[model samples]
Target: MKRPERMARLARAQRALAEVAKAESIAANARYEDSARQADEILDALNATNVLHGFAVKAMADTLRRNGRTTERLRRVADERASQYVRQERTAEVLEERATQASSEARRKEERQRIEILVSSPRRR
Candidate 1:
């Protein structure tokens, strides 16, 4: 395939990849939100309780601590995925622009070649 066409195909592939990345980022964000919400609920439960056995209190505190850590990890993962999506999106846009430029350049070159041929050819008269 021609350079311009190949570039265009590559750009399209990049766009697809970017879309996938965006979806993944969104999913990650949702997971992070869910985890955070669960952690908050756990915290609220811990605070609302006035009477609890020693073992139950320890278990709740341990669960809350674990949930907090999981929430933080999920948040970081979501942030990383979002950053990756942005990078992929920018790469797709740049590839599309380059393809357009290549196509334009090819057209201009062909036009110049045609003009040169016309100017050089002898008249049939």
Candidate 2:
């Protein structure tokens, strides 16, 4: 080929290569920007999830604490009631014992009076 023709063709090739390089660079930058946006979205979602988990854990702990306190109070009440019942039962037993002793004493007195009356009136034959 002639020198001028060859030179013109080389220039055209160089221009084409530069255009392709510019297009590639633009595409690479767009891809990088999209990837960065997705990463930011993922980070935001993770942060929100962590916050929700923390709140849930705190609420559950509070509920457990309240339940524990309630159970302790109920146990204390039951123990006090049991003690009162035992005291009442002991008092009833003591009263019953006293009543039995009094009844036995009265029966013995009546038997002695009957024997005296029968001995004194022994001339009815």
Candidate 3:
């Protein structure tokens, strides 16, 4: 209900979002790496001289080209996701810091109020 509490909750949500973004970025990068490995295998297949079927080699070459494009696209997606994750993480950090400051300020205010009350009250002998 308080400002610090609300800010803390928001910071937690942002951290969760950042974690999801980080996972997505890692997955994208893995997919790109796998695609690249497949393209390399296709190249190796094309290099084999004992291939009986010419059409198969042509098909493999075409597939390799397509895979190259896909890999590039995946790389771009991974980079974008990584950047998004960084931004989200930074936002979360800032929110957390602000929440901590607000909480400290609230405590100080309460302490001051308590001190004022104690000082103004008369002690009974």
Candidate 4:
């Protein structure tokens, strides 16, 4: 090939490689953003549920107090509410963990794809 022609080809290849790299980076970043959005949604839902639970518990406590309930009954209600709260917390933890795992997997997959593309590209002699 003529010198100018070879240089042009090299430049074209370099541009293509840069474009591909940029696309891959954008895709990976998009995936990360989507995962973060999902996590935020889950957290918001958990917070809303927790707030509702708190409101319900408070209402019940207020009602009991207004009705002149005994200490034993109040204690039992508090215990039950505590147990329920613990269960909800456990569920939130599981959901958060799953979200993190999914994000990690997505990142790994993106890395592998980038590596494969790099390795498969034709190298100039």
Candidate 5:
């Protein structure tokens, strides 16, 4: 009877060890799954950030290109307008010089006519 009791106690100890091992395995599996989920979330966030940065950089490049084209066009227009102003000033100077020459010629003709009229008229004694 003493030997049978000892055998029964050993069987109960074996069952307790098996239950503890199974519980530990279940907890370890749960921890691994939680870590996997966190890793996947981090990867997704990194991908999204990379895509946004790419778009922002592209937009900035396009804006700079457009500004460069606009600046070049404005410079061309300024050059053309400056040339036009110079042409107009030259034309005004030519017209003013011609008017001065015509006035001088008219004065000389009037003075010659007055001298001939005085010489042709009879003198009063």
Candidate 6:
């Protein structure tokens, strides 16, 4: 694809990566809140159902930990993709610069050849 299009895609990918990290953080926080609520419920039910409350709290805590780890993994993936896109953008820009330089050089060479031909050719009397 063209350099400008690649640049645009790179910007969008960077933005999306930031957004993914933010959203995962929010989700992880929500999981923590839910775990806290479960702990509170367990306390409230301590006298009436100690055994079941303990099990419920344990399960909720485990789930929260797993959710946090999953979010971290997902965030890492997003960061990797962002870096890949950045590399792609740099490559595209480099190629575009080279192409522009090559075109300029070609034009200069053509102009020089034209001048040489004109100078060497015999003029009409």
Q: What TM-score against the true fold does each predicted structure earn? A: 0.90, 0.50, 0.94, 0.42, 0.50, 0.55
lDDT for each residue of candidate 2 in 10-52, tens digit (9 for 90 to 100): 5555555555555555555555555455545544454556546
Instruction: List pairs with backbone clashes in candidate 1.
Output: none
Each prediction's whole-model lDDT (CA): 0.93, 0.56, 0.90, 0.56, 0.56, 0.63
Q: What tens digits encode model 5's per-residue C-alpha lDDT throughout 1-125?
A: 44334444544554455455555555555555554555455444545665476656655556555655654555555555555545555555554555556556667787999999989999979
- Give lDDT tens digits, candidate 1, residues 9-122: 999999999999999999999999999888888777777756564547778889988988998999999999999999999999999999999999999999999999999999
For model 4, how does the per-residue alpha-carbon lDDT over 63-124 read when each residue is reduced to its tens digit? 44543434344445545555555555555555555555666776788899999999999998
Residue 66 of model 3 has an lDDT of 92
Highest-scoring model, lDDT? 1
Ordering by TM-score: 3, 1, 6, 5, 2, 4
User: What's the count of clashing pairs in each model shown?
Assistant: 0, 0, 0, 0, 0, 0
Please list the Cα RMSD from the true structure of every candidate, rounded to 1 decimal place.
1.8, 48.7, 1.2, 22.2, 49.6, 8.3
Clashing pairs in 3: none
Which residue pairs show collisions in model 6?
Answer: none
Cα lDDT tens digits for candidate 6, 6-79? 55566666556656656655665665566556556544554455556666766666665666666566566656
Task: Give candidate 6's TM-score.
Answer: 0.55
Candidate number of the best TM-score: 3
TM-score of 5: 0.50
Once fitted onto the true fold, the runs of candidate 6 whose alpha carbons sit more than 4 angstroms away are 1-55
- TM-score of candidate 3 relative to the true fold: 0.94
